[model samples]
Target: MKKACFCGTFDPVTQGHLDLIQRATRLFDEVVVVIGVNSDKHTMFPLDQRKKWLEESLKDLCHVTVQARAGLATEICKEIKANVLIRGVRNGVDLEYEKNMAAMNHLLDPSIETVILLASEDKMHCSSSNVREFLRYNRDVSQMVPACVAKDLKEGGKA
Candidate 1:
């Protein structure tokens, strides 16, 4: 069974993230959405809340599952036995950053290929950080994120 892993903080899972996750499902038999926790960085949302948002956004996907971990993405990929690691590139900068990460992942596990999917033009500008910025000022982010996430941001308050 070919399995792919999509790892990200997914602090507030954006539409762009969903687009990639949904697309990955078509190519891989199973897509594991791993939410990586970085202790060095400050996350706007709690790990549980982030996981919940991902679950709600991806509940309809049968071949996809969500998990939370605090370690290198390559390690998580190894644990899940993923043959591929899926990443979404929104722009040139993102591509460069992802390229470096992909190289590192390759060093850690040469068997797990890193696949980068360019985001659709409409969703390219959407990101979890940008969505958080919009919400910080009380702006509507329904277009950048899923309806459930938007509702959660409004009701859940900063997490």
Candidate 2:
């Protein structure tokens, strides 16, 4: 079915993520947006909140679904029977990092291929970390994240 999986911490899904997922939907029949649960890394938002934000952001994409997994993304891809891994790169540094991860994922599972998508020009600077930083200072993130997320952040009084 040419299914693809895109995995990220998604502490808060940003517009860049939405751009990549939207682009991925055009290429793959099914795209699974996975929120990777890392026990060692602390996140600004809880897992359920992150999942809900992702779901709200991607509700219009019929062929896409949101899920949460507590292991390697490559393993999750295999478990979900996805044949492609979708990654988004904003610049050289991100490209290098994604390249290494893709290489390691290939070593782990040679059958699944990784597809790297460049972030949209407008969203190149948007990221979950940056959004969190803005929230920390009570800065407006309405332009960086989805409307639903922005509304939630404002209503929650995260700062």
Clashing pairs in 1: none
Tens-place lDDT per residue, model 1, 8-94, is 998789999999999888899999999987899899888998899899999999899999887888888888888899999989999
Candidate 1 has an lDDT of 0.89
In order, the Cα lDDT scores of the candidates are: 0.89, 0.93
Off by over 4 Å in 1: 157-159
- Shift in Å, residue 151, candidate 2: 0.6
Task: Give per-residue CA lDDT, model 2, range 1-159, as digits (tens).
Answer: 899999999879999999999999999999999999899999988999999999999999989999999899889999999999999999999999999999999999999999999999999989988998888888888999999998887788863
Span of 10 residues, lowest total lDDT, candidate 2:
150-159
Model 1 TM-score, 2 decimals: 0.95
TM-score of each: 0.95, 0.97
Pick the lDDT winner.
2
